[model samples]
Target: MLQLLRKIAFPFSLIYLLIITVRNYFYDIGVFKSKTPNTPTICIGNLSVGGTGKTPMIEYVIRLLETRKLAMLSRGYKRKSVGFQLGNEESTVLDLGDEPYQIQQKFPTKSIAVDANRLNGIAQLEQLIKPAVILLDDAFQHRKVNPHLSILLTSYACLYPRDWYLPTGNLRDSKREARRAQLIIVTKCPTNLSEEDKVAITRQIKPKIHQKVLFTSLDYAEKFKDDLGQTVDDILFQDKQIAVVTGIASPEPFIQHLAALNLNFEHLEFSDHHHFTATELKRINGFDVVITTEKDFVRLNGKVDSLYYLEVAHKFSEKDKSVLKETLESVF
Candidate 1:
């Protein structure tokens, strides 16, 4: 039924394509100007709407630039606050959005800000803290502030070339815009992806000569941890009935990980950045144990009892790591 509706929406997708193409053309011809920020900025974004593993890739970049004074800027999707807001110790999910709030919590000392206007956000970040480098979260389409380095991400399962515009498929921008990126990372890949598969994906993408392609997979932690830093053994989970709760763009890989561990649990999935109401909270509270993604844990930590979140990080092969180091170094 969903596939049928998507097929029916093909005409709408064409309209979207025309609109985006015109917008890019304007930017290309200098009718729409792109300003470069004073601070060196890196953009990690995807062509698809969701499920592209962007946040994890941003975290990976953060680790790479840990030696420098860093700040992150985001649009704060679904956040209640408006205008430019800088994250502080008192910031919550409502102030900075889930992804930024999660990042703030992980790197407590780093500066995080959110604004609809990328230029304003970058200016405010520079004026206040003067970070050595700024990481722009999900700003590939925001051509207003031209980033020094742009890293494009595509899911191993759903590459941009195979996708169409919104309503019909997940792509929010044209696949041709991918050429603007200096590095293209294939996220959510199989850990054991063979060289043949890598060559095939590169051939399909047909990247420009200046662009480099890298592959990365998710590494889920064996144990689950709660807000208080209490952890439960992975094997002990078999003794109780568990519920897998997630409010993320893609939960399939997380679910598959649990299933591969031979665990039995019912899944309670929600939309990306979904807010839980009283009724939804009641339904979630019925489970003996609730395991959720680290992103969702920020919202449900105090709201739900017996709640635990599984940690996930980007995993790159040694070869890819070296290539990533070289590519990032070249940016500076």
Candidate 2:
């Protein structure tokens, strides 16, 4: 039924997309105009609205450019306040988006800033960090900024050009918008995916010659222990059932990760950045223990009772890094 609605609405969505096309034409013709930085800028974004592994890809880019001072810039959607805020200390998921806060928490020394206006946010960041390179999170659609390198991310599950628009599909913009990018990444690839899979996906995507297409899979952090040195027994989790709560763009990866551990769970899904209440806590009381992703942990900072966040890290294979390095070196 949902698929049927998506197919039906696609025509309207495509017609609505003409608005974006006309706006882009204005920007291109200098009627709207765009800004370019003298400093290096790399964007990691998807053609779809949600969960093409942008956070993991951003982390992938940051680690690859190890020597350079990297700052992850974002619009900080659904954050409490508007405008530029440095994301190192004194920033919360309530203040910045979950992903930006997550990056700042993991990489404290690296600068992180957020604002809806890409140009304004970049300007504000220049005053403080003077980053060697700026990594724009979900900036593929931000036509106002001319990135040094544009990376278009698509999910292994769904490619945007082939998908329907919002309320029907995950894409915030049209698939043709992807041509503007310098590189394309098919993210959230399954582990042990063969060359046959890559070839099939590449053909399905039908990228341009100018685009450097690559693939990556998410690597999760397993065997989490508490603040204490004691290792949390995996046996206990297998012996007892657990409750998995997540309010994220995609919970599929986390669910699969737990399944790898042979752990049984009852999942509680919430909207992204959902603020929990006392009633929610009473419901959580029925579970043995609660496990969630690190992205959701920030909102749960003061609310922990039996909750434990299963943290994840973005790691690419050595060969994939080599491919990424070779591509970026040509640009930066």
Candidate 3:
């Protein structure tokens, strides 16, 4: 039935494509002006609507550029506060959004801010920190502020070339727009992806001479931790029946990780960045051992006692890692 509905929505996807094409045309032809800040800026985003491993990639970049004083800007999707707001110790998930709030929590000293207008947000962050380099999270579609470096992410399971427009497919923008990115990353790949698979995927993407393509897999943390900085005992999960709770774009990769570990769990999935109600919290509390993603853990913290989150990081070959670092360093 869902497949039939998507087939019916195929015409709407064409309409969406036309509208997006026209918008890109205006930007390309200089009918729409894009702002370029004096400070070096890097954009990490995807062509699809969600589940591209963008947050983990952003964290990877942050770790790589640890020496530089950094600031991050995001649109703060579904946030309660409006306009340009800077993150601080007092900032909550409602103020900075879940992803940005999670970044702030991870890097307390760094500057994190959110605004729907990329231009305004960059300006505000500049005035506040004058950061060495500004990282723009999920800003591929935001053409107003042109970034010095744009890194595009596509999931290994659903590459952009095989995707269509929104409402019917995962893509929110045209696949052709991928040409704008200087670097393209295939995220959430299997650890044992063969060279033949790489060649085939690369042939499908057909990246330009100026673009570099890379593949990476998710590296799950060895153990779970709580808000109190206490680690959970791995022995407890041994032959244990756990509840897997997630409020993110895609939970398949996380589920697969747990399954590989031979763990027993029932999934309770929700929409991306879902705000839990009091009743829902009570129900979640009933679970014996609840596991979730790091992003979801921030919101669910202090709400459920048995709750634990799995941490994930990006893993790539040393050569590709070097290429990413060198490319960013060259820009600055």
Candidate 4:
């Protein structure tokens, strides 16, 4: 029935595409204005709605810029508080959203700022800390502030180059958005991905003559305990049947990472940024342990004990590290 409805609505979807296409045309033809920043800007974003691994990739860049003066910026999606603010000190899931807070917590020294206005946010951040490179999180569609280098992220399962516009499918905008990015990466790849698969996917994008393509996989960090505080493999993940939980854009990678650990568990998937209630907790009465992603843990304001979260850290290889650093340095 759902499939039938979608097929019936296909003509309406085409109308949406036509509307989007006209809007994009104006911007492309320069009838509409585009904004750019004074400082060096590198945006880590996806063309589609979600699940392109932007957070993990942002974290990767943060670690790389440890030695340099860097300030991380974002629109702070779903943040209760408006206007620009420091992403580290004033940040909370309530104020700055989960993604910015997590970034602040992980990279203590790196300057962080969050605001809806990308232009104003960058200006405020530049006034405070003169950074070498500013990473704008989830700014793929934000064409106003033209980034020095735009990184287009595509999930291993969902490639945006072949995807259609939204209300019809998962894309927030047109696939032409890929043309704006200087770099493209196929993220959340399996550890044992073949060279053939990589070549085939890269062919779809056609390389744009000078654009660089890369592949990245998730690297799970050590086991963490309740509320993402204690690091403990002894209690939560060891010697018990577990119920894994997560409210994220993409839960497949999280599930896959857990499966690789060879742990005995039952999976419980939730909507992105789901707020759990006491009744929902009570429903999973039989599970011995409750594990969730750190992103999901941020939304849980309700009281619950014995629930642990495995904090995964994204680690890029030495070669990948050098490639990123060298490429970024050239632009900055």
Q: Best candidate, lDDT-wise? A: 3
Computed on alpha carbons, the lDDT of every model, listed in order, comes to 0.90, 0.78, 0.91, 0.77
lDDT per residue, candidate 3, 128-158, as tens digits? 8999999999999999989999999999999
Please, what is the TM-score per model?
0.98, 0.91, 0.97, 0.90
Runs of candidate 3 with Cα error greater than 4 angstroms are 238-241
- Residues 1-332, candidate 2: write the lDDT tens digits: 97898878877777767777787778778999788876688887876777777776777777777788777899887788788888756767878877788788878888888899999888878877888888899888898899898888887778775776665677777777778887788778887889898888888878888877788877876565443324465666665658888888878988888877888888889887677788886787678777777777767655655667765655556776687888776656
Pitting candidate 1 against candidate 4, the one with the higher lDDT is 1
In model 2, the number of clashes is 1
Tens digits of lDDT, candidate 1, 103-122: 99888888989999999999
Clashing pairs in 2: 49-170
Error of 1 at 144 (Å): 0.8
TM-score of 3: 0.97
TM-score of 1: 0.98
RMSD values, in order shown: 1.0, 2.3, 1.1, 2.5
Spell out the clash pairs found in candidate 1. none
Q: Give the local distance difference test score of model 1.
A: 0.90
What's the true lDDT of residue 188 in model 2? 81
